[model samples]
Target: MREPYARYLQLLGFDQTPHGVEGLRQLVRRHVIRVPFENISKLLLIRRERRGRPTTLNEYLDGLERHDLGGTCYTSNPFFAELLRELGYDADLLGCDMTRVNVHTAMRVRVDGSAYHVDVGYGGPFYEPLLLTDSPHEMRQGPYRYVLDRARDGRLAMNVFTGEERVHGYLVNEIPREREFFTSIILDSFRPAATFMTQLCVFRYFEDHAVQLQNNVAVHYRAGESGETRISSMKEIREIFENQLRLPRCPVEKAIKTLEQLTGQDFFAMGEGDLYV
Candidate 1:
């Protein structure tokens, strides 16, 4: 049988035929760079018409192919796991306690008798897979260096430092999980009170740079350079999503309206290119 993602690899800008361990790494790199980590469905109030059934794998693929969008941890992990399995890999889904209270999903893969943690939805912290081990290991890509260590609770903690701040870290358990484990949290994320419903966030990671848009602020950081941020107007936000983030234009207005509802700002009243940060 043909792999589900065999055709889409070209869409992600790959021409070489990849196989084995290197193939796994290449697949992850292409995915993280091309498919942004975003929650446009929650922002736009779009829900799958499952009629009380759990979301299916086909639904996740449709979201990516038809909508030109990526999803939160729940959707992204399941989708990625399926792609990996279809391509022939020993892959499983793992849940992490991002805040030690909320669960985040990632992939654990065993390739060539070695275990690795592959996380495409992590946005920036992980641009590549890290060796899955109890001992500390560092992987540096571009300007950021990520450290992976085992926490006292026996979970792998992925940490990264930006300047004086320990900017990002999350704890992932070694145990594998299934989609049913994240069902409730996935539902909660779309609720009105959930942060996903109110905030506007989009992140795109590349080999040397990354762009993040949170609420009305946009930041672009490059290797060996200080990050720069600016307050974005509704128009500017749309432009960034379309041109910079490489997302479809259809969801821009809905996302902007959602941000307006969250911040109570009249973006039209603001001056163009005004400094926000």
Candidate 2:
């Protein structure tokens, strides 16, 4: 394996030896908690060039090292699948429909002849490799619960819920797709009105809690507790990114500036109603 990628696996707290399914679980779990799901790079790229580029794997890993940042499905999932392959795992790249047309990337690993669904992006739908079974399987992590079901289209459907309310539905495509297939969507996400570019959405999932930052508001919560949401200052926001989220210092500063330009609000004087989760 390459040095930087090897060091990245170690950064996620893995040993020098290859771990089987257990290692995959550890990688999936730690990747989310350590690398934030944010679009600061896209935001920065668009801010300067008014367009996007193909997000390369090295760029994604370098962002994690240089800026402590994470990319969307396009960057995160493909890199993860590559990591698994480099480490000698049978990993299959998969794509899904999160929106009507937009695609979300994930992967499936056939370990010991059993296939498991693995997603290290789009937050914490699967902190572990979920057994690909026709029967419904529900897994809970921190404050949220997700139900996995096989759809009629031969894909897997992951239903995200909090308590009794269904929050989101993701339908995994039955047919697997390659990483390069998602290049267009990656560029599309950086368009002026795209969600990842315009919104300051940051998510970090842990075993104990999940933290989210949308626009200027930050929410931290766990299961059984009403999450706390408050309008945050630039200083406080930086602290959250660096401390709570474990992101590097530089990119976050740039992210703040880009956000101010996008929202036309002063973070220093912002109030509660200025943002949302």
Candidate with top lDDT is 2
Q: Model 2: per-residue lDDT, tens digit, 1-277? A: 7866787787677777567778777777778777777767777776777678877777777777777678767778888888888888888888788755447878888888888888877765466777786458887654567888877887688877778987776888756677878888776776656666556677777777777776667767677453655655667777777776666454766766786687676744444331212
Model 1 stretches with alpha carbons more than 4 Å out: 2-17, 46-56, 133-135, 139-145, 163-168, 248-250, 259-277
Residue-level lDDT of model 1, residues 1-277, one tens digit each, is 2545765555567676566878887888888877778766555544333212335655555656777677677777777787777767899998887654446788888888888888887665465666675458776544566778887877778777645466667888767787888788777666554666556667777677777766666667675454545554557766777776677544767666664665466644432321111
TM-score against native, each model = 0.81, 0.86
- Highest TM-score among the candidates is held by which one? 2
* Cα lDDT listed for each candidate: 0.67, 0.72
The runs of at least 3 residues in candidate 2 whose Cα sits more than 4 Å from the true structure, single-residue gaps closed, are 141-144, 162-165, 248-250, 263-277
Sliding window of 10 residues with minimal summed lDDT for model 1: 268-277
Alpha-carbon error at 162 in model 1, in Å?
A: 4.0
